[model samples]
Target: MNALLQQLQDKQLIWLANQTEAPYEHCQSTGFPALDQLLGGGWPQHNVVELQSHGACAELQLISKALNHSGSELLQVWINPPAHLCAEYLLQQKRPLHQLIQLNTHRAADALWAAELCLKSGCCIDVLLWQNSLQLTQLKRLQLAAAQGQSQLYLFRPLQTGQQLLPWTLSLQLMPASTGLQIRILKRKGGWQQQDLLLPWAELYPQFIKPELQQRHSSYPPLSRVS
Candidate 1:
């Protein structure tokens, strides 16, 4: 009887595996080997990703390489960025500034409206929105918009604000490490990641500031003071 139950479980597991979609089919390589491996190849396209971090800039550094590789035809849109995007830094990394569209809004509602428009228009392949708090219903709306336009949507929020469940294809918690960034995969489609992955900062941001200086300046002030 025990042997019979074990056989049934084995067949069930195989069936589940076959039913699941392979990660590489839908993911875009994040440009980091360790991260790519952890994410089952890369970030999922046509989905909403939630990035939580103490410092808003940390998320930017994590995705800079992917953004740079977006090509000329598709524009990278930034809605209410936390800090001024340093043109010199982008130049250093060889990311084309002309390919970026930045929009500033005084209210979160406006930012959400603009992000939805950008995602639904099919004009941009990547949209980054820095909004600290969003309702679950609002996130669902954005997720649907991303799916409709086949665009990758990244939403940045403070670590403290991500305690609630959200409708995200991939959700990650980024913390600063001595050598690089420590990524904790909070939620994903297939399975939960038990271990945190360390991605060297130099690989993505060769000109990253020293660990000591980065720590000294990395603090989340009030969102009102961000601009």
Candidate 2:
């Protein structure tokens, strides 16, 4: 009996010890339920997640949620959104700049570099990267940084059509929804491939979307197939 007790103690197989395992720190949401469900309960603490899209395809809710820091935690957010976007309108949509550490630059490359640095620093909950286009090299670098720091990085690409699996835990392809955005997990951690995940802005706020059907102009050009 004494030997058995010593073996059990060596393994530390007590209930109290089991309870002491570190809980997975999740990236907070913008209070949106739909989006949260798509990415397996939001961004996780120890992996890299990429968001790829273009042509009005963005993840504003996700961004807002990531910046919604708590526990007196200061999370940094680096953005290089398209120039056409109205920062004022964006501010109106998402208020309170107290928890944000944003860097608004015209060059997407610069913004991505900044995001990689922040992720490696491990000072922020997770790094969010967004831009019109993303290069393969840049993404690989970011992944390495995230791994080195043991931090989660969220990469968003505004315009990408083809699909190529990289060394990422999750790859979410976002589409613009009438209310908010649809988050489709193209590649999920643990080899889970799910279909279209839709989340509306109305889920987070009291906004109504009225889809206006307009006649397609002759020169409107052929619609590029949305993947």
- On the 0 to 100 scale, the lDDT of residue 149 in model 2 is 68
- Cα misplacement distance, residue 200 of candidate 1 (Å): 3.0
Per-residue lDDT value at 191 in model 1: 57
lDDT of 1: 0.79
TM-scores for the candidates:
0.77, 0.60
- TM-score of candidate 1 versus the correct structure, residues matched by position: 0.77
Q: Model 2 RMSD to the real structure?
A: 9.2
lDDT, residue 88, model 2: 74
On TM-score, the candidate that comes out on top is 1
Residues 110-205, model 2: lDDT tens digits: 787787878788666556565655566876787778777666666666545666645566777777765567777676544345667666544544
**lDDT, candidate 2, at 107:** 73
Question: For residues 93-114, could you state the per-residue lDDT of candidate 1 as single tens digits?
Answer: 6867888889999999999999
Error of 2 at 125 (Å): 3.7
